[model samples]
Target chain A: QQPVQSPQAVILREGEDAVINCSSSKALYSVHWYRQKHGEAPVFLMILLKGGEQKGHDKISASFNEKKQQSSLYLTASQLSYSGTYFCGTEIRAAGNKLTFGGGTRVLVKP
Target chain B: SAVISQKPSRDICQRGTSLTIQCQVDSQVTMMFWYRQQPGQSLTLIATANQGSEATYESGFVIDKFPISRPNLTFSTLTVSNMSPEDSSIYLCSVGTGPTTGELFFGEGSRLTVL
Candidate 1:
């Protein structure tokens, strides 16, 4: 099943912080984060496999709460490059490597 | 990580026609997946293409409409048949290194506009 993402869109000045949340109705085994720039393919950001696991990339970090079937991506001190559409992909129990992606949240960071 | 390349990076086709998009991986992979993303929408799995077997498609997708072929471990193709305007979307080719790998390497998607 597809995940539900909060704040379908966001606008922020450079150096501001933002949080995007993703929740799924079904049980999840892993949650993956990806970012897609305009006219580009979705790029893998990180994957959280265990419950309460947190991973970071530059100023971007994500936390997975397997118990709640939810994951949150944190973007701190956002830069212009951080402007893109973020998608959370979920791999649920018995789903193997197949991922169901969320609707996506568009982030726009301006100077 | 694997490098994937897709052919016909973008195309405009007339209704009632068919278009085949090709994907080539730099190295061998176990599973190849095809995903479709409508404009301003999330990625939806079209099917899983595995070597030496028929493709497994997701619900609302059928081989007759989105035929997939995996002749080898590094290459696969997805063809959209009898296209309609609603079929316009970006089709991406992806693959993981192994069975349990959570990260997928994706090719520059093929953007199709059916009119």
Candidate 2:
């Protein structure tokens, strides 16, 4: 099943912060985060494995809650380049490595 | 990281005609997947292409409609057969190096517009 993303859209100014949440009904083995620019393919940002592991890069971070089957992406000091759609792909099982992506959160950052 | 290339980046086709998209990876990959993204929508998994084996499609997708060919480990093709207006979307091919890495590299994607 497809995961659910909250705050369908968010607008921020440069140097601001934002949080996007993705929740799934099924148990997830890993949660992957990606960003897609206009007319471009989705680019992989980071992956959060089960066991309550959290990963981050240059003010962008993500956490996975195994018990709750949810993941949250945090973007701090947002830059203009942060304007795009964010998708969370969940891996329910480790067998096929298949992923079900969320509806996506559109983020717009102004200068 | 894998460098994935797709042919015919964008195309305009007539309804009832079919188009085949090709995906080539720089290195050998264990798993290859096809996904479709409709206008203003999220990506949806169409099928999983396994080398030398029949492709495994998702619930809403069928082999006859989206036939996939994975002749080797580094190459694959997805053919949208008997296309229609609804088939107009961005088709992407992704390669997974391994299941444990949880990372997927994607091709630029083929943009198809059926009129």
- Tell me, by lDDT, which candidate is best: 1
lDDT of 1 by residue, B24-92 (tens): 999999879999999889999999997989999999999999999999999999999999999999999
TM-score of chain A, model 2?
A: 0.96
lDDT of model 1, residue B75: 96
Docking class of 1: medium
Predicted model with the maximum DockQ: 1
Question: In candidate 1 chain B, what residue range of length 10 has the lowest lDDT sum?
Answer: B97-106
How far out, in Å, is residue B37 in model 2? 0.3
The deviation in Å at residue B72 for candidate 1 is 0.5
Tens-digit lDDT string for candidate 1 (A7-107)? 99999999999999999998888999999998998999999999999999999999998889899999999999999999999888645578889999999
**Candidate 2 chain B, run of 10 with poorest lDDT:** B98-107
